[model samples]
Target chain A: MGQKGSKVQITENDRAILQLKRSRDEIHKFTRRTDLLISSERLKLKEMIKENPTKCKSDPRVRFLLKRIHYQDHLLQQALEQLINLENLVSTLEFKLVETQFIKGLERGNQILKKLNKEFENVDELMDDVQMQIAYQEEVDEVLAHSIVGVNDFETEIDKELDQMEREINPQQQIEMPSVDKLPDLKQRPIASSERKEQGKKEGTEAPVLA
Target chain B: MSNQSELPPIYSFPPLYTRQPNGLIRRQQINSWIEIILQYCISQKCWRMTAEGMPVGEPDVTKQSIFNNSSIQRVVPQVFVDEIWSQMCEEGKALGVQDGKRDSSQFYILWRNLDSWASLILQWFESSGSLNQVITIYELSQGDGTADWEFHGMPEALVAHCLKPLCQRNRATLIKDERGIAVATKVV
Candidate 1:
């Protein structure tokens, strides 16, 4: 999608022409870069054509040979350009496929996002129910606190009545019971797992296994 | 006895038409022409060689006072000269004939001699019309698109050897191509 250059090979002749145009050094190099599999001593006629052009031209063998050499150089240059173009196109297509794959990954991420949003809504509803339960538990605790205060007053009045009756009944009814001031307040020490295990052992009970 | 006379001292001779590929023979052949052309250039005070006509079919080199080898004055063909130059360039020995349709086929062999060429190269460097700066060896051999002194079809080594005296005077330097052709550079 971006501004990419066409990756086609220009031409062997074109490359050589460009080389000739650009630097004399490269032209000199390219002119000598003959890959033709000509036998060393066998290039006699070809060499003659290149050397004594006037004399070699009349010879039919030399003419055909020169054409073949020129044709070979041309074909090789063409093939090389085509290969380069194909390679460039392949890499460009691969990059496009990678972009499509990335888009698919983004789509999957969006699906995951929707599922997470639904889970969050369910959590919000559960939290609301827990808040209502906490409020109901607070009301029950308030009523229990009021009942305990009333019970404590009733127990104090009964003690006062029992004290008057005992005073009136003389030494024959002297009842002996421990007062509330003698009992220990609720102890809130942290119990370790080890202490719990020891208590279960004293009670002759094994710790239950979790499923 | 008058009729005998040893058949007027008969002699069998070869025309030397086929240029001797021998080291000594080729040198003698080339030297003989160099001697002729050097004298001609000096006599006429010709500064540059022009390979103007059809190099392969040239007939009278000395008559036109040009770079034609097949001159009625000489035995080698203009094509032979081209062949020699092409071989030399292909062999990486500059001064030989070159090949190709361009400036590579016909060569300009200075009748002015190598010494004069050395002097001319130095003079070319001194000239104001040309941007004759000390150029790279590569520039002298295969320049991008400029057709100057190098446009004359000749071997690079020949060019370098012709400029040797200039090189010795520290006025020029021999620049070698990685592929081994000689390029000349002015010391200035």
Candidate 2:
């Protein structure tokens, strides 16, 4: 009957187990009732034999009583067999029900675990995206910090670099004024007029400080 | 017009301010926002909006609160705001500056367009027996006779554009002063 394979572990302390136990108690009650009835009939037959041992078999009333006792014994044996079958059926059904319930719980747990795994993956991807964005923003800030220098400091730095370049290029032609004025417009030109502009700015700064 | 004192219930939902990333959901959100904006404009008699889709009482008024829902403490991002404004303009629900570079941020919310406003003004002129008479733009907008009209407080620039179609059809003549400003129009 594949009985061992059908055995399901019932771990849950719930109503089905309780109901199965209750039915077993009812079956015990039925057995007890049948046992009492059969014993009483046997006792009656014994009494009849004791009272008239020689004629008990030949006596019609005794024979009728004996026949009734035999029928009751047969009925009791059949009831016991039926009760044993019912007990086996009930226990197997109970095992099967528990097995189905356990399987259902396992399947539900597996589905929830899979769903959680998917959600975790989504969260991980989102975190990576946010981290990438933060890294990009920091890089942009670094570039901006490098490019956006204070105007006064930037001008003075340019002035110093231009003075060095001018000294290296030509020492005597420094007095050329018109070309110096136009030097600001050309991209690749060595700084020339910025020296004068820097002097003007220095004067402006000192005036403001003095005022 | 519906009363302007109360805003729609969804105005308080914080998610509405966030640009939804999902395609179908974002389209639905945009449609609802457009409806709410139009309804709010109609209620408040607002005609101008900024690049950020904020309703303004006058073109000069800055920092409107339609895009900023203080109750929920959420501000629609400027990029999304600009998108909504451009969409409205594309749908002919608003008019923008002809020159793309100059103040494209400003828009005229055409809840009722220039054409409809022009027709309403012409109807008023017909009923009031003011046809064939030159009325200044100021008189058409704020004159005592126009006090109860829907276009009473409309801008003269919009009025002139609306009158252009009429002038083209010889239904009206636009007169400008030495400053080249359209001063008045005479409807025939």
Among all candidates shown, the one with the greatest TM-score: 2
Error of 1 at B71 (Å): 63
Residue B172 Cα positional deviation in candidate 2, in Å, after optimal superposition:
2.0
Instruction: Chain B TM-score per candidate, please.
Output: 0.39, 0.82
Give the Cα-based TM-score of candidate 2 against the true structure: 0.42
TM-scores for candidates 1 onward, in order: 0.27, 0.42
**Residue B16 shift from truth in candidate 1, angstroms:** 67
Over B20-124, each residue of candidate 1 has an lDDT whose tens digit, in order, gives 778787766554444443344334433234343222212332344233333223344666555444443343322323432224534444554466766665665
- What RMSD, rounded to one decimal, does every model reach? 31.5, 47.1
Instruction: Give DockQ per model, in order.
Output: 0.02, 0.00
lDDT of 1 by residue, A1-211 (tens): 2323333233333333222323434334343344433333237655776787787768878777777766757755765565456445534644665687799999999999999887787787799899999999999999999999999999999999999898887856558777878655545334555687789786664434321
lDDT of each: 0.50, 0.70
